[model samples]
Target: MIPVFVGMMYGATLGGNATLIGSAANIVAAGVCANEGRPVTFARFLRYGLPITLCQLAVTAAYVMVLSKFLR
Candidate 1:
């Protein structure tokens, strides 16, 4: 249950960085969560979101670097 909850939060929050619609959806989801008593504050969301976003950026950068090197 905990894992599922985390996954959902990550999907609704971190997943927003992918697109405009996603960003809007995450905001709405956050509001809903707050109303339900979960209260996903900016700081709390950042705590989890930042690291994941950084990791994703790192991986994507590495993949592009590798491809560029090989293709060059």
Candidate 2:
């Protein structure tokens, strides 16, 4: 249960980074980019974000399943 909870938290954290609209820090980044006349698009974000998110989720799952014994 604890490992599952940790995995969920990590997954959520990675998801938060998936979009400029999903997190406060990224919102600021998007705003700044827009102000500079370099607005980021959803497609552009997904191109990079999707792979990163997948990798993060996979790593978190592996950790929870295989390394859970080391936790706590």
lDDT of each: 0.63, 0.82
Question: Backbone collision count in every prediction?
Answer: 0, 0
Give the total clashing residue pairs for model 1. 0
Q: In terms of TM-score, how similar is model 1 to the real structure?
A: 0.61
TM-score of 2: 0.82
The regions of model 1 sitting more than 4 angstroms off are: 1-22
> Over the stretch 1-72, how does candidate 2's per-residue lDDT look in tens digits?
888888778888888887767688877887889999999887787788788888888887887887688875
Q: What would the per-residue lDDT of candidate 1 be over residues 2-71, giving only the tens digit for each residue?
A: 4444445555554566432347766887889989998776777767767777677566556655655665
**Model 1 — which ten-residue stretch has the worst lDDT?**
1-10
Candidate 2 residue pairs in clash (backbone atoms < 3 Å): none
**TM-scores, one per candidate:** 0.61, 0.82
Worst 10 residues of 2 by lDDT: 63-72
